[model samples]
Target chain A: MTRRSISLLGVLAASWWIAAPTGWTHRLDECLQAMRVNVATDRLTLDLDLTPGASVAGQVLALLDLDADGEISATESVDYARRLLRDVAVTLDGRGLSLHVVSADASPLAHLKSGDGRLRIRAHAGWDALGTGTHVLDLTNRHLPSISVYLVNATKPADPALLLGRQVRNPHQSEYRLEFTITRQDATDPSPP
Target chain B: MAVWLWASLLGVVPVLRAAESAAVRVTQAADAFVRTLNESQRRGVQFEFNDAAQRTRWSNLPVSMAKRAGLRLGDLTAEQRAAAMNLLRAALSERGYEKILGIVQSDEVLRRQGNSTVPFGQDEFFISFMGKPSVSAPWMLQFGGHHLALNLTMAGDQGVLTPSLIAVQPAMFEWNGKTVRPMGRETDKALALVQSLDATQRKAAVLAFEMRDLALGPGHDGETIAPEGVQVATFSAAQRQLLLELVAEWSGIIHDAAAQRKLKEIESKLDQTWFAWSGPLEAGKAYFRVQGPTLIIEYAPQRLGGDVTMHIHSMVRDPTNDYGKQFLP
Candidate 1:
């Protein structure tokens, strides 16, 4: 293709990119993939994930397990989900943005039921537009080892793009998981930090 | 364009002027009512009237038990209490006075249900006067009982009190085997309005997952969020009328002119509001909730004991100007 034609094509592609959903799903998936955890005991685990470039502040990881078992139950696997979202300092393109937790939900506390393992939890997150760009979800835990799981946006076809999986073992084991979502730029952008 | 804007502004000036005048008239009426109180009655009017301090003390936003329990009208002699009642009658409209009486009588309703033996005691009520009774100064008259809190704030002669939370528990009860309804009529009327909505309107109005309580609980100040999900404009004419009636029942708590002024404001925003509910709409069961832009009302039924649900809790909160924040610096 001619240089001018190539430039024109690039511009068109960029325009479409700007109009897209910011590929936040892609970032979330990436963070989930990189999540690491150390399971020491069957009851609790630890998680680790990156604090993305542009992100909400004070996002903490909450453990969601099914079966109400004292240990990670068979009904559902345990994983790190975001909690306590807040505005935090983010370095982006060399600029700063204020983060805010728009909405959030947590898992119910796990309890030991007769001798069977079970999991129970509720996960939720909503964000207030903060100059939409890219943000990260981080997880950190320090209690029950061998019980950690990291969740990432699922991309496998026929399977949900979001999945909870056990994180790899690490010595520094502060069980936590961090995730990210990239929000493409939009007009009527919120004010900067 | 600027000239056109200016012309429109000029056109609205007369209406604004009229509203201002009406506000003034309402304040004058309220003040006149207060002036009618005798000496002993005036003493009862003071905040914490039963306390030795005599002077009213400023309280934290979501008035604590210490503040509410400290003020008692029952401490006064029978004659003083009577005079105080007269003062209240003068300060509020006839309908407003009736509302107060209805709430007070609910205590007896509770007693009849064996909820409490003490009946309605003075410690159960808290009254505070926001400003001097002058027509010009910003002021408010606030009174709250177990399941009720009413605040009327006036500024530039205008009085506005909305999202008035009025709740009755044991919402349905048998008094001597006859159903006694202290606040059922109003609650049922609101429910009727919601049930009458069309599918599309209903979807718009129902915004949350399970209605539970008013979003604006005590101590949650200036946390009012904009009404989302549905706007009142979607309702049919008949449905809209029902909405207005509900709003009117609240605004009517003020005397006439102020009530009219508030009604006008509420009507203007009808298209940009929402109504939500939680729990079963049946009688004799515990359930409650109401949420809208600029207003939120909650009602819940509670079982005081003895296989009888004989208690209610209700509250109203204004998103923009609750507790007279608009009038404050």
Candidate 2:
């Protein structure tokens, strides 16, 4: 979907839903959140949950405040973060795989700003990586850990036999180098680490 | 223990082994525990020394979400559990062992309260080892579940406990007919130190940006963090002593002899240690940061929907050496 539609959703959330107290001050409380990546046979489901990064509020405000009006409409702020998902890297076997903006909701963003004080934002992105042979899955994390605390789990639930192991980043990078090995039907998979 | 004492010990490896130091005791204890694992359990517990992914696959996340490798406490038999606890005794000081047990017991309270849908209990904790346990070889003892992740690395007679997580939810909970607070020392001593600072000192000590979680934590291995907050050099001698005491509350979580050596390293770098805190200093909600040339400790409360200040997330790391780096070769 277009960024315009995503922004409209945020605006509707702000006007339709109630707002709570928010600011950098929320950092005062303890915040522990996680981002999970569940691998399916044909596609990869990426989830960003737990809580929005500590810096997300300010970052959204800065990006969406285009009019220099010193005020960012709820839609603009939420859409600004959604647009960032475009840069979310999902690759198969070392090659970049195309990602579809599956669904983006601003309720977590809205509640995070005011509602229940959970400061949560749940977003999902998916891409096709189905095949018969072996494949490797990897992604570059943008919002979660760099902004706050995030734990990534890359697992294939359908085939218990397939093993998924992750290789993390350089000091300056936020990439998860996941190597997935495929074998013949008669062959055995490598031992899990 | 002093640097000179360490130097003299280094000169004589045989005496270091025969003196019954914490390293030797822990090695013996670990050896005994490994022997009790029978056959299949041993395969699950021991990972190849070069198994990079397994070594780094630990987390403070819930078990259902973040899985761990190694033999879990729940899987052990009665005799095996006793051996596991004995190994912990050899690795941690009395206070440290109590801290680990207290954190584990809090999970048991959660199970009773029915706040969680997934599995949780004291027995859910796990133990794992990387490389063979020898007094002279470098090895690591990793034990954690839910709110605990302890990575103790030993190199010869020297020891380091860093890149570890010591966090608990429900900051204060009623358990075993008594009120329990796992991170009580970290919370109380940090507040006292913050209160001790005057206006000028407080200005330097309070961080502008509120830290919601530890800046350096799991998966942030080898990352660099610049020091923030009040440096120990500016404090009075008494205040500096207080800072050292506070540090000991975390570093000394290891065995006594090893912990003493860890303290000596920090004491030598008093001028470099920094203590910074965010949020109001009042009891319920606050975050504190303590970083130095060799150490980094953080304490932050978890905002789990309820306005009640109960859940907490804290971490302790050694910037230069974590996961027994000196022994890797």
Candidate 3:
């Protein structure tokens, strides 16, 4: 082969080689998108959408490797898990919401389980005032290295204007973004039914 | 030149791949232990697997016998409980496994002492394994219920099993007219190590203020203070041995080879570390502390249940490795 043709072939092969992993990863993204949160309630749910074929325990180990140490022993795993679960970010209309995350195997207030080929996460959000106005409930997954959130509001709102939220999901990392808007029955009313 | 670079890169890949394989093996061993459990014992293992959901609410401690076990032993059938214990034995050292059983039996002793109703005191033992048991990946073996919390982590070439919070109330209870001191020996060794230090070393080691417990609890962020107070080099030979003994009590919790490597790392830094104590050394009063390079051990004796001098709290931590130091970079 001519030198010019040989060089061109090498360039093409290198480009394909680098592009292969990204293409494969895109398929993984498609699999995760199938596990988005389509249901809504007064209580917020944060689903840990594991990648296709990824074991729940394995995914947890990967998330626990916050240091990207390539390996996570028992001590590091628990510490990372504790820190990740403890530091989860929950915001309501730009204000930080106080909530607890427990083991799915733990209490009736919070439920955790794996079914339908995904690790289902359900958590309750408490509010002191439920006024007849739009309120935003935002949840973020701080642990997963590369996963985006696709949120759908299962609870119908009184008005579309109350849907004051945006979807800013980032794939290739574990930060799923979702927002919920709660509208009161009346704009001036302080009570919520 | 290009060929050489590629060759070197390829050479490194196997090393990395081999390490990953080793990690998988470790995980499989842990999995084997889990797999051996009957549905009931498996349930006990599952109860403490705190995922994102359960952490959101204030859950109560395991109050009932069934709840405490997280799985009823009766439900396991005799064969399953034996299998579960065997799995534990396989995963831990003879000493390590025995210590766990001893601690569990000790908890039973405390429970039988009529101290069951007290809130925030010693109760049942809860065990959870995080990460698959493997030599390569990180994993944890945690056994803690009520006043006892043992957290051990094994990573590549290093293991940290500390912040081991062990507490015993009414330190000694009369069981069939015999005084039983379940957690006394470990405490006494630690206290003796502190007392062996010279006046100058003692002055440097003892914190000006006594702490009820190690300030670095589970959720605390960042290193609280620079390595200060007493240095191990200041101790005499006998005192240093005592210090090593004190640290070993916690290191002994893990049965893995990595535990010995961790002990050696702590031992090599013996001279640079410090041993400190607080409170009164007497049996009735609360007081004790030990600090070293890569190690911190603390103990406090307190009153519980109508002025009974029975409550105790102790903890061990690695200065450089707590929580994997994951916060860095």
For A1-193, candidate 3 gives per-residue lDDT tens digits of 9999999999988886445331110112222321223212243433333322222334543454457565434555345435555656767667776654332221111111111133323344455544444455555554443432232222223343344343333432233344545454333321123
Distance from true location, Cα of A182 in model 3, Å = 51
DockQ-wise, the better of 1 and 2 is 2
Task: Estimate every model's Cα lDDT from 0 to 1.
Answer: 0.44, 0.67, 0.49
Model 1: per-residue Cα lDDT over B200-232, one tens digit each: 866655433332223343433444322333467
Between prediction 1 and prediction 3, the one with superior lDDT is 3
After superposition, the stretches of candidate 2 with alpha carbons farther than 4 Å from their true spots are A1-82, A85-193, B1-20
lDDT of 2 by residue, A1-193 (tens): 8999999998877764333222112342322444445555555555443344333544443454556465545655456546656657777777776654444343333334331223223344344434446566677656544444444434334355454543343332345655554333433322221
lDDT of 3 by residue, B177-266 (tens): 766665666767766766677778877666454343333433322333324357777777888788777777776666556466567888
| Top TM-score hit | 2
Give model 1's TM-score for chain A to 2 decimal places: 0.25
RMSD (CA, angstroms), candidate 2:
15.9
After best superposition, candidate 2 residue B143: deviation in angstroms? 0.4
When superposed on Cα atoms, how far off is each prediction in RMSD?
A: 20.4, 15.9, 25.8
Q: Is the docking of candidate 3 incorrect, acceptable, medium or high quality?
A: incorrect
